[model samples]
Target chain A: MLNTHGLDVSAAIKTLVLILDLVGTFVFALSGALAGAKHRLDFFGIMVLSFAAGNFGGITRDLLIGAVPPAAITDWRYLAVSILAGVLTFFWHPAIERLRSAVLVFDAAGLALFAVAGTQKALAFGLNPAMAALLGMLTGIGGGMMRDVLLTEIPAVLRAEIYALAALAGATVVVIGQLLLLPSAIMAIIGAVLCFAIRMLAIRRSWNLPAPPD
Target chain B: MLNTHGLDVSAAIKTLVLILDLVGTFVFALSGALAGAKHRLDFFGIMVLSFAAGNFGGITRDLLIGAVPPAAITDWRYLAVSILAGVLTFFWHPAIERLRSAVLVFDAAGLALFAVAGTQKALAFGLNPAMAALLGMLTGIGGGMMRDVLLTEIPAVLRAEIYALAALAGATVVVIGQLLLLPSAIMAIIGAVLCFAIRMLAIRRSWNLPAPPD
Candidate 1:
């Protein structure tokens, strides 16, 4: 009976993770679609960017952990979310553009969720704590990196400020929580909140990492 | 005795594949280092580019097929080869640039090897023929695409000549050979030769896929 209860808890956590993942996918897809519009890409190009940005992070993480036929490819919900974001942006880009600050907030949320979820997954897959944290950071930044790459730009994570670090900090918290035997759901929520707060602060303050002298 | 012989043959094929994969990595690394040199990146930047261009394709393939801790990450040989190419380019870039045509030929060979090898691996992993062929082409082109993306440029395969198509054609030949139950080594050689020839011809003739209208 105790084992069954534990299994039930695990199942509930999995369901929560799935829902958050989809939400992350949707927000990232919106960012990708907006980038495509900025680049003057056609409908097909917008769709491609949307899909890539929405799913590439999770797909990459899953692949790294030996998850074959990644959920991004096998799950119809991911596709639907990505396509919906693309279509919405394609037709209502002006309205979406007006909401750029809101988009940034949502993007921060996506990053936070992905970072914590990726750390948890990597930990579950038996990666070392350090590697799990790195994978978490990669998950947070991977989608935006792919989006920038496709647009023929240096990845913002490499050139921009405080983004990957925030993700890493959040992921590190999850790893530490795991080490301390905390409830995973609570840790995930705490990690996401930390990451989101950091990102929001960075944006508001226009904080940046130092660059090399010219 | 016959079953033992079959095992010996399989082992031999695996060894050959490993050798070819390393060779491909070296040549692609050289291309990457050269591109970094062209861009005037610092030594560390050049090394990073070399490693990325040498291994990203294989890494991506391995991940997609659930090969964890990808060969590029786990095997020391891949690292040695990439580092060697980077150091060579860092010092002898002028001489290497003078031998640009030779480099192009080597790159073509690398492409051929990766295309055939990737297809064979995908087949061994039980992917359907069409998806296997596509994965093969991705393995052939993925490195170059990563290199270009990091440099903030459009990938040559998408913009310039008949690169990816040749890879696809070679991969398709390998798939067809598998269907026909041809000797694996012989089929690999034939596919590589066909791919090499097509790439060489395209280079000589300046063949290109059609472009969209302005």
Candidate 2:
């Protein structure tokens, strides 16, 4: 439980959430850098890719909700984090090549964490349940979408298994929990884990929604 | 100059606005395409760059104002325009290379038109005047900033010229016009041209804001 906007919560839990968010940003940024390296992007292009992947979803979400100028712009710390991540990846990426799947796993964890955070924020902002779910999905996937667009490739989200759908599920649970009078702490934990579990299961089982009739 | 929501205005001026907007899109897309060619980017990268240059600002504005999914997502026409512009540039850039300055003029005109239109839309949505003005500025410069970032460069907005300031002026006039009971037609025309003139003057005179003392 972190004190967010004056809410009382366990310090450990709250700190964990913050950690996950930072880690998510780090992993996503790393993924972008790896992609840039693959494309032989210049140093500037690598940094740009990392920054966009780390920040685009959050920026898009905040603006859509009228959080004008967005946290990304207002909080220099976040920008610093992205810049640091970009620089770190630029220096250490040769060592990363030994484990090709590592970046993928990091990105997967980011996907789950971001999905929960985005969904909860949307619900808190007074959006309808379905729209909240949609927003969560959008936020979870938007960073990758922006990255792909910038890199001039189709976004992996358009082809991935249940990635956004997992976010939608977590958002739906939050809405349901609210209606059922579940404790906020319990709801948050359950929702976050549900997002992670669903995503993990999808990956392990190679699960994906069947293609619609063409 | 055109009717929006419940507001009615002159149709002739609306046509002019549309034409100006398209011309702006053409030049903006050209800038994006040129960047792609500089990098020897693939076809996908070229299209993506063109799309970002032409659409990012408008998309940002719309989403911030609660226009969900934004026109850039729901409308195919915008995508079509970007693709067409990119294809044309790819095929005929050699001829256009002689008219680089002229393209800047067109881009400046676009900045003005988009600024006014963004402000007008914000007002229609009942946002505060200051916020409306900010949104207008964002709309005018957002796409180019995005394009630059994608190409891994500093945003032009931070460099020089009255781009965002011009948008702010145009939007401010719309706000004042509404208060003064001025005609919408006159307000839009004057506002847009004021934006264009301010930008052109800045360009011609090499006007710039001083950087903060380092």
Candidate 3:
């Protein structure tokens, strides 16, 4: 019953989204691998950390939203991507560290993509708008949080710049777009751009959430 | 085609399992809250840690096995039990800390219970035996792992006494019992007792996994 033109358009959009997801996974994996290198973890440890950092956020979100057997576990491509990132970082951390700003930008991009994707997934699963938005933020920050925890550090999401808040902004935008019945491709782009812009600005301006009184 | 006596027996077993599960949740919550208190976290942080410690293991297990809308979220009693334990620990940490041996015993009990329960749940959901057993161990140790991470400490499971191994033993027993078509109640009890005994022995004798050479 579907028109060929409509099917082609949807397929192209899906392909675009999938590429974005893989890019997000790769950047996150690189970050995890870098953290492992900084800590002098063994090779196996680096790979494990890379996979955890790249996939844990989506895994957690999938678990919470009842998307069981998470994509991270079931999909071989994700595993390959994370491992490749780890191997690359392990071999070239010195060079990568010099590109810290670039890493941050990629991380921000990943956060944007994850926030929109997570929100859309939650809505698909029939969650309320508020909870969906929260899950989106969680999906954006959860992997980094887990990575820091494994390194025995307080999560950056809890202590650093407006990371979680930016994800929240993006997710909220997605939810509003849902309410307005906007095309998902357009909404995702808008939400991702908003999140990426806010995160970059936070980094540039050194914006931080208020800390608890010591 | 339902038999009255069979239904009664099943219902009674279910009740027993539920009671054991709640008890396990409470002890885990107590340990988490105690850790939070040690770190000088505020009341809200303590509550969050308690909830994470009490429920994350089961949540993880449920997610892996495709149990949607995990019981920890949908069931009110689990929330109440974790909250109560947190409140008690926050107000009485000094007294609780004085009873370190008692706390360890309770932790072991919870570990045993969760191991058996998690394995059974996985089996019920039709996971392969080896996978179910692994999930059971994860159910036993996952919460504490998350708790330690949140507190910026290495998980005891990765560095301490025979924690995860004991859970695996218990879960293996459940799997073997299932293969033999043993009664659920008896299998659960046997598995729990075995896990608890092994854990207690390991603590008493200072058993540890082999560490990497420095």
Candidate 4:
């Protein structure tokens, strides 16, 4: 059995969470850069969109939980990751566009990671379970929503996707695990896996929430 | 001369700020609802847009300043004001639309109020003068940006007009007043008036920022 209660384990979990967060930021930044390229925005505009898509979610989550300055603003790593993604996409977008499926996979992974991490952070901040779950979903979807918004598109989550539902399900799992006193690191993994699976399956099956009739 | 340091005076200022905030909320909500109606969205959609536009700026400002739960989320007044505006617009959109000029005037008022109020709040929270001014501009523009985003339109502040610049000028006035040890209420009034004047003049003169060549 793993010593989940050990100080070392907690520190390791924290480091792991940070790594996953950076990964998510990178992929979302890629999406933002791609969107900016599609719109033929200038290099500076692409960089702005990349950073907005990479960090808006975490920034919003931190602000909502009263974490002053937000990690995206305070941590240099977030900025570096976003800039790296933006530069790559700007210079090599044709190659990136050819890997659309791969990008979708990375986006799904990012969504799952953000949802679980956001839930854990909210819980740590003493938010109630319900609110924590909601915030988690918000954290997962916020970047994409902001990206779409900046590009003048209706947010997919509010339109035709099963995106937010997957995040909410993952967040709910984390919240339930917390209630059951499960090891948080393990629960985070399970929740993220569940979210990633659901999102991937939805994509494969073309699953969509019902929309108002045209 | 008013005793600016007196507890009673401070309380009065607080009340006055609240009133102005509510007024801003109401006018922004009206704009959102009107936008929804123009887009032919249903009543529910209009209400959602209204509430989002009315509260998003204040909520964002509070969150950035580490105020938990946000005044918009915690206070019933904000909700009531948004709902009132939404209901009014939903039922009487034609009559309201006929007053297009009046709506523009109200929007200017809302922008001015939000800019000064956001700057004051950020300063109170110990943010630097530069950041406070930026946040003030953000607060003034955020709601309309969100409304436009939801409707899949480019944000007006980003594309054209002197909208955000006007807000920044207003916020700068408040920040300078604070630095000079001036009374906050007087500064807020001056800032609001200056912002309102600038926005109205821009509308009258059809002023626009330079755009990229087509």
DockQ, every prediction: 0.16, 0.07, 0.17, 0.16
Query: Lowest-scoring 10 consecutive residues by lDDT in candidate 4 chain B?
Result: B1-10
Name the Cα RMSD for model 3.
Answer: 6.7
Candidates' RMSD to native = 7.0, 10.1, 6.7, 7.0
- The sequence of per-residue lDDT tens digits that candidate 3 reaches over residues A43-142 is 9999988998999999988888888788889989899999999999989989999999999999999999999999999889877676687678778887
Ranking by TM-score: 4, 3, 1, 2
User: Which 10 consecutive positions of candidate 1 chain A have the poorest summed lDDT?
Assistant: A1-10
Across residues B19-116, which tens digit of lDDT does each residue of candidate 2 receive? 67767776777788877777778888888989898888888887767776777778687788889878877777776666789988888888888888
DockQ order of candidates, best first? 3, 4, 1, 2
Which clashing pairs does model 4 show?
A: none
For model 1, residues A177-208, the per-residue Cα lDDT tens digits are 99999988788899999999999999999999
Model 4 quality (TM-score): 0.61
After aligning candidate 4 to the native by TM-score, how far in Å is the CA of A132 from where it should be? 2.5
Off by over 4 Å in 1: A1-51, A64-66, A72-145, A154-214, B1-15, B179-183
Per-candidate TM equals 0.60, 0.56, 0.61, 0.61
Q: Alpha carbon lDDT of residue B16, candidate 4? A: 84
* Model 2: residues with Cα > 4 Å off, grouped in runs: A1-15, A100-102, B1-95, B99-214
Per-residue accuracy of model 4 over B108-205 as CA lDDT, tens digit each: 99999999989988998999999999889888988888888798887778988888889999999999999999987788899999999999999999
